[model samples]
Target: MIDTTRLLSGHREGSTLPPLSLDVTKPGNWVVFGPELTAAAGPWGMSFSANLTPDETTGIGSWTEDVFIKTLRTGKHLGMDTGRSILPPMPWYEDLKAVFAYLHSLPPVKNQVPGPVPPDQVMKMLSTQ
Candidate 1:
């Protein structure tokens, strides 16, 4: 059976690579994406996975349920009414409560992920790709 506590907490006790500041050391989880899947980097530039842990100061700990729903529904960052679209490769839609539930249930990790690249740069990269 899956050790959900370890999986959800980002615990990489079995990983080969060293930890990153992006790693949560209290439990020591690595950002281990599968070999077939990769970090998103195309016309939209690069986007790392988000730190969904409930660290109020650094993670989505402040986002309300309404905001989370709006984010999925509108594809806007922080579910802002006018924020940038969630960007490519996300394949998002409405009614993401299960996802939110999983995220909110995790121990609050404090990793600060990078933001999206500028639109112009992404356009340039997309054209090249």
Candidate 2:
């Protein structure tokens, strides 16, 4: 049986896997999929997975249904016209009202996810390595 609690709570910040190398064609270089989603280091730099629970502070509890739908539909943070692109490997999908409803139904979890690191920073870090 799926542990809905852990699934909804997300993988949390400290549990995130280390940034993956860009050479995904290698045999052992596959991306890992989990409750925290996929964290990829590519041209876009590093993007941490979001906390999908309904926690008011760290999660999506404060988001309106419209905002949720628009975020997925438009791939903009908070669905604002001027908001930064939501970034990938987060895909934009259609028909997510049911998804929105189900996510909101899950118990709120207080996990705080880190934001994305821009490409320049990633390059700088890689150069120093």
Candidate topping lDDT? 2
Per-residue lDDT for 1-129 in model 2, tens only? 666766666446677475455575344554444444545545565666777889898889999999998988888988998999986577675458977998999999999986786857977766888
lDDT of each: 0.60, 0.71
N/CA/C clash count, model 2: 0
Residue 29, model 1, lDDT: 42
Residue lDDT tens for model 1, 11-36 = 23343433334433233343333332
Local lDDT at 105 for model 2 = 100
Ten consecutive residues with minimal summed lDDT in candidate 2?
25-34
Q: What ranges in model 1 sit over 4 Å off?
A: 1-38, 94-129
Q: What's model 2's overall lDDT?
A: 0.71
TM-score (all chains, Cα) for each model:
0.45, 0.53
Residue pairs that clash (backbone atoms under 3 angstroms), model 1: 10-29, 12-29
RMSD of 1: 17.2
